[model samples]
Target: MTIYCDESGGLNAGAMTFAAVMLSPQVAADIHARFRSVTGLRGELKGSRISLVERAYLLELFDRAGGRAWVAMARRDTIGGKPGGAVPSDLSVYAALLNLAVGRWLPETGGVCTDVVIDDGRYDPVILGKVREEIQAGLGAWGRASLAESHRSDGVQIADVIANSLFNIAAGSPRAHRIQRIIEPMLASKAIRVAELKDFG
Candidate 1:
């Protein structure tokens, strides 16, 4: 399986989220094609740019595609952030969380090799490159990690949606209530694994 990674939220929202969405290559391509046919998406499909109905529909596709997700969240009023004017340290925690999320699905035994693609939307190439290398060092011989722009990646874009949806819920956004309804079944069934980083700095 190939896992796509992305991050959402920040200190301004009192939280940060990093998510990994795992899917077969074919499924990822299919989902992208289907979503585009339905929405006529001209450019990158971003969670922040989509409507509630579209969000619901995408989640439905994820469900049907049997997509699995793992998310790590840090809740702190003074935590590292990737918002405007972000520092390199701001991505340290996010990288840690990304590692945690991807580790969840990695096979501990047997020979298994998986690809990890992270969205390079938040920081400059050099800093995010370091994060990619950090993740690479941990992948062992069974996994590979790399960074890609979300707009160019359907998997990364979907990862963004997953991260964004949960961020809204944890941040208590006005639409969280409705968004919760759309994803309640997946949460209940544990198709999407969400764990808050407890006692996190």
Candidate 2:
């Protein structure tokens, strides 16, 4: 199974959106449990700020899981109601980042693309479809893919919580940091634009 999680509408001029994709049910549970154990997050994950420590915990979990787990990002084009000075608008760059991250988790050969789940929200299928197509095309079209609309399952929900926190952390980290600096050119380039969840809706 292959899963996807993401955040949309945040990081620029709107509310932060978070999501994740899972490739295995058992692995998903293990990931969620580990997150809860490490972060002490209780109850529903809606509208919660996953702490920095919890974010770190998940990165470690993904690292140890050694499976296909990745984060796709769309930097906000504007901040504080002002035009984003210079973020690029290349979706492929972000898509490449997402693919590279997921590719590491998927097997190099004979990998079945069984699951490609995402949070069910107002986003358009095109956005998700574009990402999946890029992954498959860049990888292979034989990979099976599906979306988990309105994910009510416990495992998927938890994955969503974990994914959201991690993406926010990576995108919102201090500008002086390494990862932040690495992506700064991408973020400051003109490839980004103000996108709305309803655009996908």
Candidate 3:
């Protein structure tokens, strides 16, 4: 099974989007449990907020998850703008990156996957559609893919908080925020940030 985590912006930046995708329920539960244990979390990891403990737990989870995990960034694409005018929103860009990550994880059989989940947030169906298209294209004609979106007021907040902390850990918080300005637009539309074992450049 493969689980992915990603982020849309950094701390230097004002806002960011992040997400996590897992194919196996057992693995997902184990990852969540490990993180909770590290953080000493007694309640649900729902909502949009995360504490320092939670952040630490996530780092540990990543370490155990292995390095092959995938990560993608929506940094300046050489033109200081979206790759193309058609994908103008941050959500679309995030979706595009998600597509790329999922593309990389497709099984050889090209079977359809439907256990996917996305956090609830501000975004348009149009951008989501584009992301869906990208995911399908990535799978080719062999396998199929499906999307599932859900709301957890707490999880959303937790995702944002954790994402910011991860960015800080990567570099300095100051730089992370600075990068946020440039990266937020790319992440604006994502349901949540995804995580991978590899570092982003």
lDDT against the true structure, per candidate, is 0.82, 0.47, 0.44
Clashes of each: 0, 32, 36
Question: Model 2: per-residue lDDT, tens digit, 1-201?
Answer: 655554433444323434434447777668767777766877744324555445445545644564333344444432223364443333433444345445544563465544555454544678967666655564556455444554444445655544454444445644225333332332344221122222210
Greater lDDT among 2 and 3 belongs to 2
Q: Let me know the TM-score candidate 1 reaches against the reference structure.
A: 0.89
Kindly report which residue stretches of model 2 are placed more than 4 angstroms away from their true locations once superposed.
9-11, 14-22, 46-48, 76-113, 124-144, 149-201
> Which digits, one per residue and each the tens of the lDDT, describe model 3 over residues 41-86?
6655642355444554554454445312334444333213445544
Against the hidden reference, what TM-scores do the models get? 0.89, 0.50, 0.53
lDDT of 1 by residue, 1-201 (tens): 888999888755767888899888789889988988998888888787899999999999998999989998876544443467453344666876887787776763245688889988898899888888877887877788888878888899899998999888888888899999999999898889897665443
lDDT of 3 at 47: 22
Give candidates' CA RMSD values in order. Answer: 3.7, 8.7, 8.6
Better of 2 and 3 by TM-score: 3
Error of 3 at 122 (Å): 4.0
Candidate 1 vs candidate 2: the TM-score winner is 1
